[model samples]
Target: MKIILSPAKKMITDTDSITPDGLPEFIDKTTEIQKWLKSKSKEELKTIWKCNDKIAEQNFNRLENMDLYHLLTPAVLSYEGIAFQYMAPSVFEDSQFEYVQNHLRILSAFYGVLKPRDGVTPYRLEMQVKVGIGETKNLYEYWGDLFIAENSIENPEDIKGFKRLGYAFRPDLSSEIEYIFERKIETMTR
Candidate 1:
C-alpha cells in the first residue's frame, strides 16, 4: 500500500537526530537531470526555474554544487510544507516511522521518485517543471513510462478536490489533478 505524494518547494537541511536509512531508487536518473541543469548558465536556469534573481542564484549555486552521494538527509525529514509539517515525522514513533518507510513515496522533478527514507539533498524542482534530457521535451516525456512500468500501483485516487457525496467520495470531473491520478490508475489497471 504505497501512497504517492508531491514534493514541496520549501525544504530544510537538518538530520540532527536521524540517520538516513535508504538510498534513492532513481539516483542515476536524478544525476542525469542534475548534469543537464549544471550545464546551463545561471540565467538559463533562472528562466527554467521561473524564479526571482535571489532564488535563481541560490538554486543555481545548489545545482552547481549538487552531489548525489554526499550531504544527504532522509526525504521524510528533508521537506517542509503543509502536509509534511502536519506529518511531523520528527515525533513519529519507531513503528510509525517504519510504516512511513514502507508505505510512502514522493514524486519529484529532480529525484524522479523517492521513498520516505531515501537520502536526498535540498533542491527546488517541481514535478510539473519542464526539463528536456536528450530528445525528451519535458519531465513527463523524460520519465516516459518509467514510473508506471516500475511500480505496482493498484489504485490511484486523488482526494485533492473530491467531495463526500453523502457517504461516498466521488470523483470531480473538472479536477485535472484528480484526472491525472485516475488516469494513471486506469492505465495501470488495464
Candidate 2:
C-alpha cells in the first residue's frame, strides 16, 4: 500500500455517481483507504471529514489572499500507502484556475513529485516545479488513467499513469499571521 499524487486532472462530471466519501477513487487507492476509513463509525467519519474541510477551507482562503505568504506544508498524509490527489471542492465545482494552482502547489510541495502534462499549465509555472520524486522516493502505481479504474482498485500493480499533484508554495512556512505592527510601533517609540 502506498500513496500517489499526479498533476493530470480530468473532469469528473458525474455528480450522482460520487460515493458517500465525496471522492470516487478515480486516482490512488494504494491501500484500502476507503475500507480503513469505513471502519470508523458514521459520526467519526463525519467528524474527520468536516474538520478537514473546515481547516482546508480556512487555510486556503488565507493563502489565496496573502500573495506574500507563499508557502507549502507536508499535507501529512493521514495514512501512508493510501495516496490520492484532490482539488479543493470549491475549485472543482467551478473551473476556477486558482483551485488548480493551489491544488498543484499543495500536491507537488508535499510529495516532491508530479506527473507533467503539457496543456495543464503554462510553460513558466510548469518549469518551476517539474522536480521528479527523489531517487529514494517510493510510490506505488494506482493506475495511471484517471477516467478508467472502476471507482477503485483491487490489484496494486494496475496503477500506471499519473494524475495532477501540484507543488505547494512553501510547506515549512506558517500560515498563521502575526501582528508585528504593534511590535514595530513599540520598538520605534523606544
Candidate 3:
C-alpha cells in the first residue's frame, strides 16, 4: 500500500522560544507566518521536489513526492475571522504522529489498498460515516474515518454500518481509521 500527503507547511507558534540551534525568538502574528510561507518561490519548489524525490527514492517505502509544490497546501482555511490550520491528507499522515490537528484522511480518486466504509464523499464534507465490511470497494471508498466527539458530532450521512465512536483514536490508529477495512480485505482474499 502507498500513502501520499501534502506539504508540511509551517505555522508560527506565536510565542518566544529557543530554537533547536538555541536562538531566542518570539513568534507572534499570522501575517508573519503567511509572509514566510509565501517566501518560497517556484525555484524553491523545484529544489524541494528534487530533494524530496531523492528522499523518496532512498526511502522507497514512504509515499512519493509527485508535485512540484505541495499542491494540496490550499490557502489557509478562514473561520470566524481567524485562520484555522489547513489539513492535507498527505500532510496529516506525515504529521499524524505529531497529533496536533485531527482531520479526515481523504481517500478518494487513488489506486490503493483498502478503503473506509460507505465512501470518502461524506467524510470529505466533514460528516460522520458508517463503513461496511465484507465488500470489495475501490479507491473511492477508502477515505478512512474521522472521530467526532460524543454528542458533539452531527448525524451521519445516509450510509449505514459506520460504527460511531465505538472506537478510540488511541494507540491503535489503523483500527480507529477503518475498523471494517481488514475484514473487507480478508473477504477479498477469500
- TM-score list, all predictions: 0.77, 0.20, 0.16
What tens digits encode model 3's per-residue C-alpha lDDT throughout 152-179?
Answer: 4454331233333232222343343343
- Stretches of model 1 off by over 4 angstroms after superposition: 150-190
Give the winner by TM-score.
Answer: 1
> Which is the better candidate, 2 or 3, if ranked by TM-score?
2
- Candidate 2: Cα lDDT at 142: 22
Predicted structure 3: lDDT: 0.25
lDDT tens digits by residue: candidate 1, 34-65 = 88888789888888888899999888777777
Tell me which residue pairs clash in candidate 3: 5-90, 6-90, 6-91, 14-27, 115-142, 116-142, 117-131, 130-162, 131-162
Off by over 4 Å in 3: 1-64, 68-146, 149-182, 186-190
Q: What is the C-alpha lDDT of each candidate?
A: 0.73, 0.27, 0.25
Displacement of residue 3 (Cα, Å) in model 3 is 21
**Could you say which candidate leads in lDDT?**
1
Task: Give the per-residue lDDT of model 2 (tens digit) for 1-190.
Answer: 2234432211122223211222212223312333333344544543543446554444334323322111211122121222223433322333443333334322322222332111111001111222223332112222222322433654533322223233222324423331111101123353
